[model samples]
Target: MEYVEIARAESERGELVLRERRDENAPTVLELRANGVFVMDTLETSTEQALASAALALVDRPRAVVVGGLGLGFTMHEVLADHRVEKCAVVEIEPRLVDWMRDGTVPHGPALLADERVTVVVADIAVALAEAPPSSYDLVLLDVDNGPGYLVHRTNAALYREPFLRAARSVLRPGGALAVWSADQAPELRDTLAEVFGDAEAQSHDVVLQDREEAFWLYVARVPSDA
Candidate 1:
């Protein structure tokens, strides 16, 4: 196996690194790391893509969507696939990650950034959600950290708390939905969402890697049209 460094930077949150690695029998893979924690790569993005699809499925006509994290742009790309989505805002804490995408460091980055309906916001997702007007978005998808159990940044833990969840709910219009991606099943997160949204469902998706099968989780909560 051979590894090559692509780019590295320091963000307000922590250290961010991008690299490419190639193996004898496998294709070259681009990986992203934040504060020495492994984030995501280009190997398999089914879970990220599923996050968008599953969330949109719950809404009738989702026009405005906000994605919490913009890792490799897979989630945003998937969100744009639905013609019903007229505006898509992606909030990323690290500006360097967005720069890498804009400069073509990530393979699928250019196309997603080029989309007219997409808006890239370089800011903390929590702040963005808090500042958003009430009932403004049709859907909100969160893929920032790994999950409640594992956090790339300690500060990100607040995002899964009751307060943030409530704030996220407040930004959703009636019948709008909020979706979260977790590297593992998070029962506590499900319960928290249930408390905030009145109901929450956890869906498991399986992705086959080179050596094993991994189960990723998605949590979806919707506001009733009457609410």
Candidate 2:
């Protein structure tokens, strides 16, 4: 199978590449890459879906959601699947990524961008989280990089640290949940979430790829209603 380059852009974080690959056994797959590293592909998005579903399940009537990273819009789309979600704020650091999605360069682009309840912010997620008012959202889902261990850019390491987690927590309403999607299990991250949220659990999702079965992780933490 041959992968054709769909588009490329020099993003602030790194070089962003979008490509399409076709296989005889599967439908056309769109892939998103950053700094020459594979971010995600449209073929299988269970981890992203689980990131939204699992988090929303922990919150009651989640009216507002903050999603960090807009990879192919899978996470955002899954969040919008729930009718209870009145506002879905997505923060993407790469402006070109948003442009590609809005311009139909990506398959899942237009619908997500056109959703009335969805707001796409072309800014760093950390900045967005820092500027968010306290108790503003019902949920915060992050899948900015593969995980804290596999960041496309070294600077993104801050997102998975103690301070960033604290910032994310401050933006969530009482009893709101924070969920993060990781390509692999990170016990350290789970530990950090526990330290910040008082409690945290890691949910593992089994995913079947073309050649093998793999697992992803979703770390979830909830704010105390009294806090």
Candidate 3:
């Protein structure tokens, strides 16, 4: 098991590194690290895919979607897989990572971004949500950090709070849903979602990775149909 560094960049926040792992017996894996912390990889993308699927299921007509993060593009990829999705807006804070994806540093990136339904916005999701047109999206899927409990950046904690949740809700069309992915069981996050969306549910999933079985959670809430 060895990792070969493919690309690296330093941002004001921290360093972003992309590495490739190759084993004669296994498929090549692309790993993304932010500030020297593990972010995500191409090996096991089920969790990300599940996040998109579950969120999309909650909306009766999921024509527009906002993805809060674009790590490796797995989540967005899944969102595009649904033909019902006509527009996908991806807000990513890391410009370098976005460049890598556009420049073919990430193999699957160009194809995913080439989708006519996709739009990439390089900015903080908070700012993006703040500036978005009201009732513009049918679904808002956030995977910016690992979760509220496991944050790669301290400031992302604001995302799980009422103020930010309110902004997320404001951008959703009536009956639209918002979903957040967390690496840990975030009871507090579920509670916050409930507070903001009136009612929320948390779904637990067991993902069997190459090394171990990890538990992931998805917190989901929907706006009232009449609202």
Candidate 4:
């Protein structure tokens, strides 16, 4: 495969190096740190799409949506694609990812980043959730790292905990849903969500693009409004 150096590696965290590869098929990403840790790439995004689609299926006439993680903007794109969505806010902890999308390093970056309906907030999503409007957003989609099974940043694990889940629940509108993407089915995560949301579920779906070699986990938790 022929490749061009569209963007070079840069360190956001202590030893984390992020690089973008522009090739004929698509411009993808590579993230590494002190160890040989890798994050994600462009070839696969079934979980991202599934997460967004699942939440969208539950919410109707959603005035806004909050998406955590800007990994290639696949989830953000899916949320914005919905005509019923009036506005969308995306919170990304990594500034480099936002910059990468801003400068068009990856495919469709500019279109997604500059979309009038999209508000890209460069901050930790947990912090953003602290003040995100109450009963404001109909959906909250998070794919910040490798999900509940694997995490890119250690602190992100809190996002899967009760306190953070309650915060996310607070920001969500009644009947709104929070969808988290995981690399593998997490029964523990399912239980955690059930404890926090009072109702939660986990579903597995196979991706046609992955040639059946891959499957995605969709964890949906609903925040019910008081009648």
**Residues 39-135 of candidate 2: C-alpha lDDT, one tens digit per residue:** 8899878778877888889898799999999889998999999999999999988898899999999866997799999999988899999999999
What is the per-residue lDDT of model 1 for residues 1-227, given as tens digits with 9 covering 90 to 100?
89898999986677999999889898899998887778889987777777788888989989999999998998898999999999999999889899999998886788789999999998999999999999999999998986777888999899998999999999999999998888888999999999999999999877776668888888889999999
Ranking of candidates on lDDT, top first: 3, 1, 2, 4
Q: Give the alpha-carbon lDDT of every model.
A: 0.90, 0.89, 0.92, 0.77
Which candidate has the top score in lDDT?
3
- Show model 1 residue runs off by greater than 4 Å: none
Worst 10 residues of 1 by lDDT: 204-213
**lDDT of model 4, residue 208:** 60
Q: Clashing pairs in model 3?
A: none
Question: What TM-score does structure 3 among the candidates reach?
Answer: 0.96
Q: In model 3, which regions exceed 4 Å deviation?
A: none
Encode model 3's per-residue lDDT on 92-143: one tens digit a residue: 9999989999999998889999999999999999999999999999999999
